[model samples]
Target: MELWYTEKHTDSVKFSIQVDRQLYSGQSEFQRIDVFDSKEFGRFLTLDGYMMLTEKDEFIYHEMMVHVPMAVHPAVKRVLIIGGGDGGAIRELVRYPTVEHIDLVEIDELVVEVCKKHLPQTACCFNDPRVHLHFEDGLRYIRHCEDEYDLIIVDSTDPFGPGEGLFTKEFYGNCYKALKADGIMVNQHESAFYADDAIAMQRAHKRIVQSFLISKVYQAHIPTYPSGHWLFGFASKKYHPTADLNGVKWNALGLKTRYYNTRLHAGCFALPNYVEEMLRDAE
Candidate 1:
């Protein structure tokens, strides 16, 4: 017999992977967590039966999420990450010598511990001195914070289950209040290829523009994720993602990033025709 792991991307569409073995499976206070080993993607983790990250392509998502904002504002010192329990985003963040502090607020503590045990590649950076772990609801955490962080990264799951609140307009308002004057916020904007995700992408874009002076969406090709085309939300109070970006300064950092580069950072924000219409009509 062969063991396979499957997730429903839609009612009629499903994705399956041939698993070498199941490393872990248990339910936390929040959702079901599972980790598996596969020949193609290597080790991977899922929350509530949804694929969160895989070892092979994990660098793409992590690099894109952390590098884009850092490139635009190299002076960023204080940062906050909400819902990145896997630690991939933080792994990229602590690389910047300019960063002085980072607060990682994750609602589920079990996800962090489990990932630390089985997904060490992405989870290895939790011990960085700059990172202060807070096992609490991110929505509630940001709601109570004011003018605290130079950047906020919402590395959340889909818009259902534990991640639902992070996608709401009210939460975006709280995130706006949680940022400094020129703060930049990046979030997991769902893909535009599917109907459900496109609706989510547009809705998120509409709500973010209400609170941010500059709002834009960017794309990344994550082969394991649904549709293989993923999007990220970029919003700021005072900087254009490209116009104010000092690419020359960012390149000078000389980081060895597999997926994100200075040129691609600006290019990703150039939305496709259909994607542009989706965001335009979202308002």
Candidate 2:
């Protein structure tokens, strides 16, 4: 008998992975958490029956989320990550020795604990001195902050459940207040391939556009995610993702990344016509 793990991407579409064994399974106060080992993707994590990350392609998401903004903004000393409980974003962030402090606000404490125990590959950087963990509501956390961070990464789950509040216009407005004059906020904009995800992506972009001086969308391909095409939202008060990117300065850091490079950074923003149309309609 084969043990298969499946998730519904849409009403009629589903994705499945053949699992060697179920490493761990538990329910948190917020959502269900499961870890499974597979022949292809190594160890993977899921929340509420949704695929969060797989070992094989987690690098792409984490690197793009961290490096793109880091390349654009010159001095990103203080950073705030909202809802990245798995620690993949933190792992990529701690690489920047110049980054002085990191505040990670995760709503689910169980997500952090489970990821640390089962997915150490991405969870390894939690103990770094620069990382300060706060298990609280990200929405509430940002409301209390004003001009505090140079970079804010909203590595949230889908725009529902605990993450629904993060997508609202009010939340984007608060994020603007939480950042310095030149701060940049990058978030997990959902996929454009499916109708439900595309609607969510458009709504998120529309709200961010209303709040920030600069708003843009970028793409990446993560096989485990819906349709293998995922998007990230880049909103800033000053810096433009491509125009302000200092490739020479970023390359000088000599950070070896598997998916993100200065060249790819520019290319990712070149969206498809349909995606552009959707964003325009939302605007």
Candidate 3:
């Protein structure tokens, strides 16, 4: 039997996926974790009925999540990733030679285990020595952390369950505190097509803007996610994103990438007028 992955964007519109198989589905301490193998996306990861990642386009999400901020801040040496148990984000993060350490704070251990066992391609970064796996609440971890990291990426799931607090003002304040004075943070913001989630995105925008000197939203296309479009929030204390690529090499290792390129990097920041309007009206 074929299972379908569906996210109700609205009472009138919904984004759905047709899958070949359901690999895993159950309730964790926080929410439901569902893994599905799809004909188009290869494999799909879902949390609390919301689609998170898909095989065919996972690189787009992971690459933009890691590279955009890293490119802007060439001095990034230490990094923190919150709730990216699939390791896709880490896969992209470890590509930077300047990075000395990476602390991964994920609430659910099973998400890591499942991805490792079933989705090796996505879970490959778990073996990197630079990565420190911490199976703990991300908010709590960030709260106690001082000015330690150069970059912090909130690779969380949707903002409705265990991931809800991740989008809160308190958490944004903690993220601001956890980073160095010149540090930057990138978070997985929701899509603008979903009215309720779009509203949530507005609130997140406000919170980050209040906490950081530079706050901007970038866009990308992720078909697995609701609305087939996604946004990422970048907030920094001192540095603006375009400051300098003075002596930097974009893909130093020649690490093969599918979606992210220097051209696409700049293009992602070019938001449509409608998206800008949503953000403006949000303010």
Candidate 4:
């Protein structure tokens, strides 16, 4: 018998991976967590029956999430990550020698513990001295902060359940306040391929546009996600995602990344016509 792990991307569409074994399964106060090993994808994690990341393609998401903004912003010393308990974003972030501190705000401590135990490839950076972990409500955490960070990465789950509040205008407004005058905030902007995910994507883009002077959307392809096409939101008070990108300076860092490079950074922002239409309608 084959042990298959499946997630319903939509009511009529599902994705499955054949599993060699279930490595670990448990429930946190917030959501269900499961880890499985597979012949193709290696070890993968899921939350509440949703695919979060697989070992094979996790680098693409993490690198794009961190490097895009890091390349555009001239100097990013202090950083805040809202919901990356898995630490993949942190792993990419620590590569920048100019980054001095990172505050990771994760709602569920169990997510951190499980990933550290089962997915060390992405979770290994949690012990770095620059990383300070705070297991609390990210929404509440940002409300208390004002002009504190130079970069804010909202590496959150979908815009429902534990992540719903992070999508609201109130939260985006607070994020605006939580950053320095020239701060940049990058978030997982959901997918544009499905109706449900597209709605969430539009809603998030709309709110961020209202809060910041510079709001833009970019794309990356992650096979395990809804449609293999995922989006990231870039909002800033003082930087244009492409116009301000100092590709020369970023390339000088000599950080070797599998998916993100100076050239791809500029190309990712060229959205499809339909996606651009959706964003325009939302505006």
Best by lDDT: 4
- The 0-to-1 C-alpha lDDT of every candidate, in the order given, reads 0.93, 0.95, 0.86, 0.96
lDDT of 2 at 120: 99
Write model 2 residue lDDT over 90-174, tens digit each, in one string: 9999999999999999999999999999999999999999999999999999999999999999999898888999999999999
Compared with the true structure, the alpha-carbon lDDT of candidate 4 equals 0.96
Q: How many angstroms is residue 95 displaced in model 3 relative to the true structure, after the best TM-score fit? A: 1.5
- Candidates sorted by lDDT, best first: 4, 2, 1, 3
- lDDT for residue 127 in candidate 1, whole number 0-100: 94
TM-score of each: 0.98, 0.99, 0.94, 0.99
Q: What CA RMSD would you report for each candidate?
A: 0.8, 0.6, 1.7, 0.6
**Poorest 10 consecutive residues of model 4 by lDDT?**
155-164
Off by over 4 Å in 1: none
lDDT of 1 by residue, 1-283 (tens): 8999998888889999999999999999899999999998999999999999999999999999999999997589999999999999999999999999999999999999999999999999899999999999999999899999999999999999999988899999999999999999999998998899899888899999999989988999999898999999999998889998898898888989999998898799988899889989986
Worst 10-residue lDDT window for candidate 2 reads 155-164
Which 10-residue window of candidate 3 scores lowest in summed lDDT?
244-253
For lDDT, candidate 2 versus 4, the one ahead is 4
lDDT of 2: 0.95
Name every residue pair that clashes in candidate 2: none
- Write down the RMSD of candidate 2 (Cα, Å): 0.6
**Comparison by TM-score, 1 against 2, better one:** 2
What is the C-alpha lDDT profile of model 4 across 1-283, one tens digit per residue? Answer: 9999999999999999999999889988999999999999999999888899999999999999999999999999999999999999999999998899999999999999999999999999998999999999999999999999999999998987899899999999999999999999998999999999999999999999999999999999899999999999999999999999999999999999899998999999999999999999999
